[model samples]
Structure formats: C-alpha cells, structure tokens
Target chain A: MTTENHPIDQLFKEKLGSLEKNPPAGLMDQISAKVAFRGKIRRMNQVKTAIGIAAAMLLIMMAGWYSMDQTRIAKNQMPLQIPQINTPALAKTNQESLDIKPTVNQIAANQHTIQTTPAKNTSLQSAKPSKSLTVQKNKVVSASVSDGASLLAAQTASKEPSKAAKQEENTVKTKAAEEKTVVKEKSKTESGSNNFQKKNPPLYFADAGVVKQTPSRESGKGNWGITAELSPSVASQSVSGATANTTQQSTVSGGMLASYQVSKRIKVSSGIRFSQMKQDTHTSYTLSQTSGITYLQPVDKAANLAGDVSLYLPAVSSIVYSNGMKTNPTDNFTSDIAQELKYLEVPFQATYKIIDTYLSVGVTGGLSTNFLVGNHAIITQNGINLSNGSTGNVRDILFSSSAGIEVGYGLAKNLIITIEPRIKQYLNSVSSNDQVNYKPTQIGIFTGLTFSFN
Target chain B: MLSVTQLEEIIYKCREENNGAQTALYRLFSSKMYGVCLRYARDSSEAEDILQEGFLRVFTKIRQFEFKGSFEGWMRRIMVNTALEKFRKNDRLYPVEEMSIYEATNWVDETISSITADDLLRIIQELPPRYRMVFNLYAIEGYSHLEIGEMMNISEGTSKSNLSRARIILQKSVAENFGNEKKLVKKVL
Candidate 1:
C-alpha cells in the first residue's frame, strides 16, 4: 500500500525526483502576451456590459417621454363644430321680407362700380358666404339669418346709396331682437338636446368689423412624429495595414425613430437601430491544438484584418463537407469562412427640408454610436457549417457618420411615406488589434411611414 | 538561488503585478517547476504548455497566496492541478486502453546506477495517460491514493490498480534496457 516499500516506485522516484531541466526559450514571452490579451478582453467585456445597460435606460426614458407627450397633447386640444347653411335660400328670404325686387342685371352692373371703391370692396369681397364668422357657446342659433340680412343690405346699398344706410340700421335692430329670442330658446332646449351641444359649441356670424378670428387648424400640425423604418442594407469593409480577399453580403437593418420639428425647414431625430456586417473570405488555415482545445488557425495570421475571423475548435473529431461527406482532419485546408458582426446602433440625425409641400424633399445627415452585440465566424465547405467559433479583437464600440437625400409623399393630412438613400461610413476601425484596420461601410434605401402629432 | 528575504520581496512585488518581479520569480523557480511539468507531460511541447499555463495562474492568483506556506509549494500544486485539468479534458476524447500487468524483473545495483533521469523520463512518457498520472501523483508528489482518486475523478481502488500496473511496466522497461547493458559489460570483461 505504501510507495516506499514498492521496488518499482522507489527506483523511478530516486532517479527522476531531483532532476531539473531548463524549459524551451520564449515561454515567458508567450505567457506575458496571453496575460495582456486576456486583460484587454476583460476590459472590453466590461465596456460592452455598460453600453448595454445605457442603451436599455435610453429606451425606457424615450418611452416615458413619448407617453407624457401624448397625455399633454390630449389635454390641450379643444374641438369646434360649425353648422352648414344655404346662402342663396337665406338671400331670397331676406328679399321677400324687405319687399325689394332689384333685377339681376342691375346688381351685376353695380358690382363693377362697387369694385372701384377700395374700402367698401375690400370689406364686401373678404366675406366668405358659406363659412361662419364667429363661434359662441350655446348662444348663436339665429346668427346665420342675421348674416344673410346683412349681405342683402350690402347688395341693396350698391343699388341705392341713401336707402342702403337706413336698411342696414333697420337690419341691425331686428337682428339684436332675434338674437335675444334665440338665446332664450337655446337656454330652454339645453336640457332637452344631446350632450354634444354642450361639448362642441356652434359657429355664428357677427357684424362685419366685429368678427372674432378663429385659430388656424394648420398652425401646429406635424410638429412631432414617430417613424418605423426598415431597410435592406449592403455592407462592405475597408482594410488597412493588411490584405484580405473578402466579399461583402447584403443584410437587413431597421429601427423606430422619433423626430421633432425644430423649425419650418429643420427637424432632429434620435432612436435605436439594428444593423449587421457580413462578409465571406476564401482563405487557407491550419488546425492547431492548444490546452486541449483545437483552433482552426489561419496560416496567414497577417490576413486577419477584421479580428472576427478566428475559429476555436474544441472537439472536431471529423469534418463533414457540404455534400454530406466526411474527411479526416488535415494539417492545412482551404475553406470559405463567413464572418458576421452585428451592432446595436443609436443614431442622432437632423434633416433640412428643401421643398415642404404635398410632396417633400430633404437632405439628411448625422452620426451614430454603434455597440457590438453579435460576433460569429463559421467555417463552411460549400455552405455546410463544419465548425463555428467567435472572432476576437473586435472593438466594443464604433462611431459612424451618414448622409442621405430624402424624398417623401404625403399619404394623408397627418401621414407621409418617405424614401431615403443613405450611405454610412465608419470613422474608426472595428478591430482593436493594432496590426489590422477594418472599417465597414453600409448603404441602404430606408423607407418608412411617419404619423404626425401636434 | 534566491534568499528567503529576496524571495519574500519578489512575492510582494508579484502581488502588485510587477512584470519585473514576475520575471525574477519565474527565473528563480521555473527550472524546478519545469522538472515537475516534464514528469506529468507526455512530451516537451506539452510540458511547455503546462508551464506557461501554470505560471499565468500563479501570477494572476498570487494575491491569494497569503504567505501561509512555501510559495514554491503553492506554484507546484498549481502546475499539478493544471496538468490534471488537461488530462480530464483529453482522456475522454482519446481513451487509452488498459495495460496488462507485466512481471517485475530485478536488476543489479550497477545496472540501476547506469540509468539516467532522462532515460527514466523517456520510459515514463511512454506509459498510458491514466497510469502515468497515477504513478506521478503517488510516487513523486507523495499524494495518497484517496487524494489522487479525488483529483482524477476515479475510485480509490482504480487508482491503486493503475499505480500497480504502471510500476510493473516501468520495472520491466528498466530491467530490460539496463539489464542487457550489464550483461554486455560482463561478457566483455
């Protein structure tokens, strides 16, 4: 049971126990490199986690702002309803009541002469026959009939100037008595009529010079809008300090944006978006095992421009090709590797409108902060995933700037459909590895529907 | 050779992650630790790997050493544990066959004296992974069967069996190689 009594254990221990041999050269350097690399990786992970938390907080804050803005807008809006009246019928009734039979030819001839006087013509021409001049709450029932009597008095004055003054005085006195009677009738019918009459007051006409101006409905339209945009993006990467044969593949990007109209010509927006960059490279690699884990190490490490193309293979006993064929592991093999890098992009953009109309055109430009969210590298032999691993040395954050020309068509009074052709270029390299500089560029046609709110 | 006071100073500096102190400490102990790694590794490359990995653990976890015992002993334990982890990861993928127990052969004292440590190391590296691990843990490191079994994830009975099998193989190899040399020398005389 004891190793001391065992002859074989004793003989081997006595020979090998006190032996010492110098290790191979450069082992210490390798350890130092690994330690520094691991430290960098830890720092990058911390930064990534911080960015993720900040992005979540921004989303929550934006949602809170949107809900509060909706509540405020709902509280500030008031409704006004105007009644429709037939202008010609009221004019005929006023003629019969006054017993004045002025011929149509005579009125037409006097209309030209009335246009020569600037003051009278301005007052007469500015009147809208079908629209109400004033709105009052539950007290304007006979306002339309009074407006008709005043229009008839004006036409009669154009015919006979002396009688016109007396006619207008009589019309005003009669309109005052009718307004008092109508107010008393409305007061009596208030309880009998529906609640709509209390909620939405009626429109009425006042004397020509005493009319109250209604607020323009177009004053604050389209001040704030939310847009959901989707785009099919084409992504490409530019490399410096290294050479790589890579072809970029198309991917999809989309996000929701909230915009505020700061002025008549300028608008600003901010929101979160999802974007990706994918590329395929045909390269040669050798399988190297380290610490019981096998790595598909690229033969030309210098060609690793993006830092996301390294593959770690743990238990690759056999390789299966795309045609469902198996092969033993070799020292070196040529394969197509696809590298995908996805980012959570937060963009701050501003647009300047060139033409604001039913159909609008604008120029847009801004910058975005891109946080890396996904990194994957797959080794495939004719479209088969033989082995999959993650790339290393990717930066946690990247900054990109974009510009575009936007064309939009108004789909409705409060909705517009827009198309933007944009190009985004990264300002810095996506890889943290000092030997390689990999910056990606993206082009997309973004189309979105915007719903406007005051 | 480093004095006790100098070694303590190096440990303090290493705790602060000073690169120079780490190099000094490694220079002081790496030869002895590499000798330890070679006994457990199958080849020189694997021994280098174990050395690198073990030293990294030592430098990163030096703050926890607490100066409770010999710093050298602590580093040796880390090297052994790193080797054991590598064994556990690889043994499942490349399972070794059980070796039959060989009859033990006795060799004269002169023949045993002729065998160098390098020759013995070459012989031990040829043993199966599990047997080699058990033999090193039991014979050189002075671990009991129970402790070896717990570290290697095996039953104590299995550990004893492996140690027995390993001794038989090593005993047979030493006797054959050196016993033939003794026979040649006597024939020439």
Candidate 2:
C-alpha cells in the first residue's frame, strides 16, 4: 500500500489548486480616455498661447517703430518745408514790383523839389544885411536917398519880400522834409523786410533741395542689407527652487552683424519661414554619490550645439508706413503675424531703418510658432535608487517663446549680415509631470543672411 | 484548475487592459493564493485577511512583471514575502526555547502514508505552532532546510532539527489515530 500523506499537505495543495476557479474585477473605463484627451488638448493650447503672445508683443513693437519712423520723416521734411515757404515769399516779393513802380517815381519827384527849395532858402538868408533904424530926416534922406534908395529899397524890399516868401516856402519845405523823413523811414523798413525775406530763401531752398536730391541716396538700403550689431543685453530671471540647480542655463548669445536692406520694409508678409538655430550649451555639475564614503565629483563639459528647426506661418507687417496708415500693406508678403519655429525662427522681421550705411540700427520683432521637438533628461537620485528599476518617466516642455535682438552692419546695398542670439523661456513650468522635478528654460544663438530691396 | 498556458494568457491579457481577462485571471488564482496566505497566518480568518491584501497588491503590480522566468516562481516569491511579513508581526507568538538534557525519543515508522487524508489532517492540527510551521514548510510546501533557514532567519541546522522533531510528533499522533481507527474497525466487526 502507498504511504499515507499528511492531510494538511493535501489541503494546502487543494487550496493552491483552487485559485484556478476565481478572478478579479474590471476597471473604470471612461476616466482614462478623458485624461489622455485632456493631455493632448492642453499641449495644443500651450503652443497656441505661445504664438499668440509673441504676435501681440511683436505688434506692439512694430506699431511703436512705425510711429517713430513717421515722426522721423516729418522731422526731416520739416526743414525742407521751410524752403518751400521761403520760395513762395520771394516770388511774392518779385510780384510786388508791379504795384510799387508808380509810387517809386512819384516819391522821387517830390524828393527832388524839396531838396532844391531848401538850397534857395539857404542862399536868401545869407544875402540879407543888418541895418539901423532913424526917424523922418533919416527917413527923408533915407527917403530922397530913400526915394532913390526907396526905389532901390522898395525894389530891394520887394525882393526881400519875395525872399521872405521864399523863406516861408522854405519853412513849408522843411515841414515837407519832415513828412518825407517818415516816408523814407517806412521805405527803409520795407527794404529791410525784403532783406529779411531774402535771408530765409537759402535755408528753405537748401533743405528742400537736399531732400529731393536724396530720394535715391539709400538705393542699396532695402530689407536685405547686411547688418552687424552687438547688443549688451541682460535678462533678470528668477527660477523655481527645482530649476535653481540648472541656473547655468542663462546665456548671452549676441554678436556683431552686417546686413543690407531687403525690401521697402515689409508692411505685412503672409508666408512660411524655415528657421534653423544651434545652441552650444555647457553644463557643470557636482554630483556626490554616498555608497560607503561620500564621493564628490565635479563634471565640467560642453554639449554639442544642437540644431532646432521650425516651420512658421508668419503674418508679417511693416514697421514703417507704406500708404500712411498704421494698417499693413496689402501685398503677397504681408500678414498679421510672422510665424516660424520659436527656436528656429526665420524672422519675417519688420525692420525700421534708423540710419543707413555707416551705422544703421533697426528694430526687428516678429511672431514665432513654438513647438517642442525633443528634450534633455537628468536622472538624479537623492537617497532614492533612481536608476535601479522602472520607477517613472518624466516629460517636460521647456523654452516655448523665443525672442532676441538682430543687430549687424550693411555689408552691401542688397545684403545685411546679422547675428541673433535668442532666448527661449517657457511661460509655464516644463514639467506637468508630478512625479519628477525638471528644468525648462533655454537660451541659444542664430546667425543668418538677409536680402534687401527698394 | 487552470493550465499553465491559460494562466499565462490571462496575465498577459490583464496587463494589456482587458477587463474580462483580468476577472478570469483573478477567479482562477484566488483559491490557491488563499492557501499560500493560510500558511503564514495564525488561523483561517487571518489567512483570508492575507489573501485579500496579497491579491490586491499582486494585481496592482502585475504590469511590472517582465516574463523572464516561470510565473509560478514569481508568485511563490510574493507569497513568501507575505509570509515573512506575518512572521515579523507575530514574533511574540513563538514560544521561548530552553536548553535541556539531551535525549532522543523513539522514532516510529507510523505508516502515515496509509492514513486517510482526514486522519492525517487531524494529526497536523494537534501539533504545536512551532512544530506545525516547520513540518508544513519542510514536508508539504517542499522548502529545503536551507530555504527555511533563510526565510525564518535561523541556521540551517535549526530548520533541520525543528523539522525532525515536528515529524516525530506528527508520527506519534498519526499512530494514535490509526490505533483508534483499528478499535472502531474491531467494534464494527
């Protein structure tokens, strides 16, 4: 007979065997789908928000530049307008001769008569002699001699009366002379006014002439001009406690650029742009792994410059007025937002040319489509075995909106070489993942060419 | 009742988020898992408590299972972990042992193999806690002396001695049950 078995073993085996007969419950279905869908929608909204904010900011900047450009044109034209006013005044003075000719001749005749009459009165005063006066005999001798003398004196008296009359006339002439003095003073003032009018003619004429002569002076100065610029810019940033360790991420990537004018500044450009940007980042980390003893290790290294490209549909508008309104120009190249990859932005820059050739500074800003293509992962363990097993996966979206200055010089009439170091900072935290902590903002540099046209 | 292929399929499907498969899986494995829980428990009720908790954890962590080795081997590890946890909780239940004079008792070949399943079960029930645990793990559960040593944190020699003592006690009880059965047979005759 077979050896009898312990009943507990059979019971244990039976219970173990009986597990084949039971099963667990089902899971809740709709909640999981809702969570996944919400994740996709949230990602899309984040991208749109980045683009929208960039567009609004660009619009504000372009508007500011356009207003400034208009003011500049007005200032340049103001000096030229002065000459226009002077030219018309000179022409009016020439036309005034038609009205002044008759008055001039009449005044000359009156002046000549007044001058000769004064000379006759002066001679008559000199010819008169002083004499003593006696009574009757003196009057008789003076009468018989006075008869002859009387005749002579009467004649002389008559002559003297005539001379006295002439004197009276002379006194009238003096009064006339006084009146003429006022008229001459007025004519002198008129001539002085004409001289004042002559002085301003050259100012208005020269300013207007310079402006007219300068219409094509900036011929090679269009949108594609090479520009070389250096911007000493600084950004103040406060990162969250989690991102503080990655603070070496702050960077300055600006350089001198020379660019030519591309076109009459873009009023608005509605097209796609392909942009590629590269960033060489160096990170220094000090990691201590305490297995038995505390091992302190410092790693200082630079990562290869990574390239990012974005396809942007930018609604680009000009910063300077095309048809005198703030509205953008109606052209094939004009749009409301200049869209491109935020990281790899082909900036449909609305550039306002401040000056030309020697030192031209333009403010260029546009919209960018922020898309996250890849990410960097940092696995850190503090008293936790982070790499031991499959604990969790962390996903973050860093550096969404990209912006910076593009400064350079005009290399030629049609080419502007520029260097743009951009900063892409995330508006929201990169990690929506609750399990792991991550850092999200990044800075980079871009160098490219611009073609300008008139 | 489930074949190995069936168990593998159920676990795979459950990991893939199939509800019907998960339920089938739970039903198929629950009873045997209950037995594993019973070994580490002080009573049937405690065993049932462990069964529920163990199954819940097993299902929750099932996705982490990489099909590298035998599924049964994995399950066994989980059951042992559960048992060790119970032992830690009930440490006070183990009776204190005192060294005494060395004497070997008569070891009978009680012919336990000839006894009915019910009689053998009664013999196991009559054993003290220390003896029962040792005997169950060594004889029925197929744990080697070394494995038992590691699990209970004792020397392998201690596991061997405990198993030997438990077997002797179980043998005597089985002999008595047989004697009683013989008397009943005589009476019936």
Candidate 3:
C-alpha cells in the first residue's frame, strides 16, 4: 500500500533522484549582486526608520519647549505690586509732636516718640518723620521763648519787681540753654534724614505709590532656539555628458532645526531636513525581451539624478500590459519618464546677524550631508502607468552646500517668524554611474517659526 | 566532497558573509540543488531562477541554520520551499476530473534501463503544476500524503488524488515512449 514500492515512483526515483545538471553561466554573479544590493537596501531602511523616530522626538521636544516658554513669558508680563504703608497715621504723629511746647520734659517725650516709630515704612515715610521732627523742634523753641517773655511781664504787676526780674533772668538763661540744645538736636535730625534719603533712593514715585515692574526686552534673549521650517523648492540639475533633454520640476522641502547662539551676532544650528529633486525626460525606447521577460530599454542616456535611464527601467525590466499580459518585443515606444529622488539631509549651518533687532536680518551658510531615502522612476503613456522602477546608480549619500539670507521678525517675546531664501548646490555628482555627470541645484524660500528658550 | 569539519568551516565563513565562501558553497551544492529545482520547474530557465533565489536565501539566512540535522538536508528543504512558494505565486490549482487508475506496467530490465533521468525529468516537468508538486513531494521526496497536503495547501484526499493522476499520466508517457522497445527486447530474447 506504500507509494514507495509503486512502479512509477520506483522508476522515477531510481533514474532522477541523483541527477545533476550544470546551471547556466553568470548566475552566481547575479545572485551575489542581488545579495549585496538587498543588504544595502536593508541597512538603508533601518537608518531611515531611525531618522524618522528621531525627527518625531525632536518635534515633541520642540512643542514642549515652546509651551513652557509661553508660560514663562506670561508670568514675566504680570505687574509687580509694591507694599502700601499707613501714611495718614505717620502725618498725625508729626502734627501732634509739632503742636506740643518744647520744655525739656516735652523735648525728651518727642525724642521718645520718634524712637518708638516702626522701621517698616517706605523710604519717603521714614524720611518725612525725621524732617517733621526737625521742623517741630525749631517751631517749639521759638514759641516757648515768646511765651516765657509774656509770662515775665504779667508776673511784674503781681509781685515785687526786683524779685520778679531776678527770677525771670534765671528762667531766661535756662530757656536759652535748652533752645541751644534743641537747635543742636534739630540739626542732627536734619543731617540723619539727608543721609537716609541718600542711602535708600525711592524706587516708587512719591505721588503714585504703586510700583509697576515690566519685563525687560533683554529677557527674551536666549542661547538656544528651535525652528520648524518649510519651503516650496525649485530643483534643477546640470549635466556634463548626456543627450536627452531633461526638465526640472518643483518639489517641497522642510525640517526642524535646533540652533545655539554662540554670541550676540553669531548662531550655529544643526538638524534634519527633507529635500527632493524631480526631473522628467522625453525619450525614445525599444521593447526588448530576455528569457520571455519584456523590458523597455532607453535609446539614449537621460540627464537625471541617476544619470542613466537604464538603471531605472531595468529594475522592473518586465513590462506588463493593463490586462496583465507581457508586452511584445516588436513594440517601440516613445514616452516621458519622470524620476524623483528624495533625501534626508542633516545640515550644519552658521548664521551671522547683520541687524539683530525686532526686525532682524542674517546671512546663513552651511554644508549638509544628504542620505538618499527615496528613489522612484515611472513611465506613463496616455495617463496609464506602463512601468515603474527605482534608480540604481543614485548615491546613498551626497554632500551639498547652501547659502541664504535670513530675515526674521519678532512675533512675540519668545517667538520669531523667519523667511530665508536659500540656494543649495550639490558638491558632488548624484550618480555613481560613470556614463554621465549630474549635479543638482535647489532654490527655496523657507518660512519658519522659531521659539527661543531663554 | 567536503569533510564535516571543512563544511562547518565554510558555513562559519558564510555566516560572516564572506563572498569567497559563499561562492564555494554555491559551487558545491548548486548542481544538486538545480537538479531538485528542475523536477519542480517547468523549464531550465525556471529551474535556474529557483536555484538563484534559493542560493540567495541560503547565503542570507545561513546564520539561522542550527547545526542540528544534515546541512544538505536543510538546504534541500529550502530549495523545495522556494520552489513551492514560486509555484503558489505563479500557478493556481484547478480541479482535476476523475481519471482511470493506472496499473503498473511489467517491463524488462533492459527497457527500463534504456530510459534516462533526463527523459524522466522532461516527463515530470510536463505534468500540471499542482500534480507535479504533489507527485514530487510524495514519490521522489518520500513525504506522506498528509505532509504533501499541508505543504501544497490541499486536503489529504486531494493530495492523494493528484498523486494518482500524476502517476497515471507519467505511466502512460513511459509506456508510450518505451512499450515498443520492451516488445523488441522480448522478441530478441
């Protein structure tokens, strides 16, 4: 019942089980090439994923920084309230001291009243007390002398004239000595008040007792900032050796940048940027078949990021019709092939401020390391996609240098809106293929929102 | 032929992705693997494709191969799986009509000896894709009907049926190609 013992199984196994045939030549080379290429692609994908995650984290950090900065600015804008003192009570004490007559006992009592006053009053309040005491001492001294003279005249009529005159002379001498002492005390009080005024200059106006503290404009200056920039980029390329006519197409570029202010007029920045170059070539091609697989082979090399059309078209060499049938070799086609190359660019730039003010202008220049992340080429005939593939000879890494003028306007205490018109030129050829030399140039007016961390 | 120690050394080098070692390994096993591919492939070109893809997988995934069982057996399994995947992608299984059972033909040893492996390979390749797969897995590879069903994504009954049909068609071809030769050999005897 076992199929193993069956005649047909026995026959085929005995004859074909150990059969070996030499495979066609050059297959090993093909496999090796594929393995290396796939390895590169795998590594590229890993790097791209890492960059993507890092970019996302950068954005989150920027958002958090911006939110915290706004809160700080709001707190800074709030008005400062100065402590109010009971000025009327102090004025009443001054009036009461002034109205009392300056006998030796009354003078001693006034000195005690001045010493007992609280020290927590404003500088003006404290100075007023000393000034008022000096005035009171002077007024009391003069008024006491006048009253004593009047009392001496009244006493002459009521008693012995000689006895009265001798008593008045003793009383006048005592009053004159006390007035000299009061005058000396008043001069000391006046000097003390002048010294207090000199030491504690009033921050608040005497008339308008409230203090309003506005945050200084210099508080907005910080060493670090994060900018999110975007631009509609115009991409073009120069070709040294290519026959096909190629036209540049407009694309978009943007990124988040972290900047550090090194000095008042100089700033350095580094971050990730995304850029793309697209080109369309109108060319003629011949349909070729290899091992029953159809291919659209270009007649001439096209000027592109890859520099050659063969690399793009040969990747998906087989051309399948709309009905899922392979195309015939006899079919010759003329079409426009569009190739787009995208890169993840990391730029190290420095900006020098020409005018660092609310409306600031700066000149920026830098070099960027661009990693090729996306490369795609597609052929379309009459709105139908004929074939799609990727450019092969495009370099994985490219170097570019950019220069621009940055014009920024301060929108808030911690925010600025900037517009930078930049021109980037590739430092090396985009293609690794030796058939053609291609270098792409890009111009973009980048508009960005910058948040400062002070 | 490589000794066990030498084979392990080559495999070690392959794990490091040494191109020389990879090429050496390919040179050692490619012919045998291509033979296996040819049985499952419709043509030499398809066999070459399978061999190329299979060797690429072997080189890339060499690190995953634990030195448990036979290395050749592991590689053979990869080649077969590669073929099966290609078959699944390229061909859809269609329902086959009920066929008459093919009884074993009695032939002289000389007539059987006259048929070469290439002739048998050609006949096997001519079978329908599913039947060819089921027959190869069941007959030459010595897999069970249930195992063939799982590998080919068919029911066990369907596997058995396909193997029977494949055998019937193969038997008719062998008989047609070698029946007259057997008669001539009998006449000479």
Highest TM-score, which number? Answer: 3
> For each candidate, what's the DockQ?
0.37, 0.07, 0.40
Local error of candidate 1 at residue A69 (angstroms): 4.7
Question: Top lDDT: which candidate number?
Answer: 3
In candidate 2, what are the lDDT values of residues A1-454, reduced to their tens digit?
Answer: 1122544344334433223212122222232344346456667657645653444344334434544653694343212101111334333422331123322222221111111132333333233321111112210100000112211232333344455656654664464455456667778998998899788542210000000000113533333233222122233233232211222322222212223334533222212222222221223223222221111111321111111111111111221221222322232111111111112222233444444343444444444343343332221222111110111121222333445554544333333344456555545433343422333344444443333344
Candidate 3, pairs of clashing residues: none
Question: Residue B28 of model 1: what lDDT?
Answer: 87
Residues A388-453, candidate 1, lDDT per residue (tens digit)?
Answer: 466777898999999999887655444556778999999998878666577778999876656567
- TM per candidate, chain B: 0.89, 0.68, 0.91
Which sections of candidate 3 miss by over 4 Å?
A1-3, A77-454, B93-101, B180-189
Consecutive 10-residue window with the lowest summed lDDT within model 3 chain B: B180-189
lDDT of 3 by residue, A1-454 (tens): 1356888889998888877888988989999999999898778657655654454355445445544653684333222211122456544443333433233223322121111111211122222322212222211221111112222233333232355444544554465556567767887897998899799853321110000100112223346777777676897767655566778878667777888777777778888887888877877667654432334555664444455443222212333332334434465667777778889898899888887776888899999999999876766554433444555567899999999998876555556667789999999888887765777789998877666677
Would you list the rank order by lDDT, best first? 3, 1, 2
Superposed on the true chain A, the predicted chain A of model 1 yields a TM-score of 0.48
* Cα RMSD over interface residues, candidate 3: 2.1
The TM-score that candidate 2 achieves is 0.28
